[model samples]
Target: MTASKISFACAPVIALLGMAWGIAMAISTDHSTAPVHAHLNLLGWVSLFLMGIYYKLHEEIDGLFLARIQAIIWAAASLLIALGIALIHMNNPVGDPIAAVMSIVLFLDMILFVVLVAKSRQ
Candidate 1:
């Protein structure tokens, strides 16, 4: 499947998982990891869905290795950042470094996304 299809397909799955997590959190009465849940929904679900839509709309953006690389980096970084935030909330010192590095990856992914979209328009 194409990168856009991969992105679009994963979004709802991630969103459903996020919702289940939220419900579990509510039931357990432990909102300590709300940041993780929030990030999972926002970064994993919403942002990914939007990026997929962008790719779908811009046909000219297809077949670019950077687009696929961005998607891969984004998916990995999102999971890392969310997990890191959760771990950090639980007082794990290692979480900070994990999130910090992944944050940079996510930033670079965004920059690449913008550049790809811009180039597609040219």
Candidate 2:
């Protein structure tokens, strides 16, 4: 595998980190860690690697607007996820706005994923 693939593999590391952090939070009674850990796992790890794979194999996507839509959704999802994770970690109430944006980004990403899968099957 190339270095990019290796880097992609590290995405799961973030999920493991989230799990570890969650365990720590569970024992410590810290209110901040649960959401932060969840975001780290779901966004930092899973979504990031998924986006990279999406872009890398985009030819398989097979739609006129899919590329642009994927780009926008991926970028937005990454940015909002990072921002939301940070806000959550720092105990900032700004998470509401960040989460809202991330939610929309995730929705778009899911739609694109389904469309790409359907197209690839044809």
The candidate scoring highest on lDDT is: 1
Tens-digit lDDT track of model 2 for 6-112: 32655666667667777888899885656667776777677657755754564554234664455455545654665676686677889768877787877777787
Candidate 1 per-residue lDDT over residues 1-122, each given as its tens digit:
56687788788888887898899999999998898899889999999989988888886775567787787678778888988898899899999999999899899899999898888764
Best by TM-score: 1
Alpha-carbon lDDT of model 2: 0.63
As for candidate 1, its clashing pairs are none
Per-candidate RMSD vs. true structure?
1.4, 5.2
Which stretches in model 2 have alpha-carbon errors above 4 Å? 1-10, 16-20, 23-32, 46-59, 62-79, 85-91
Those runs of model 1 whose alpha carbons end farther than 4 Å from true positions after fitting are none
Question: Candidate 1: minimum summed lDDT over ten consecutive residues — where?
Answer: 59-68
For candidate 2, list the clashing residue pairs, or say none.
none
lDDT score of residue 116 within candidate 1: 88
lDDT of 2 at 88: 61
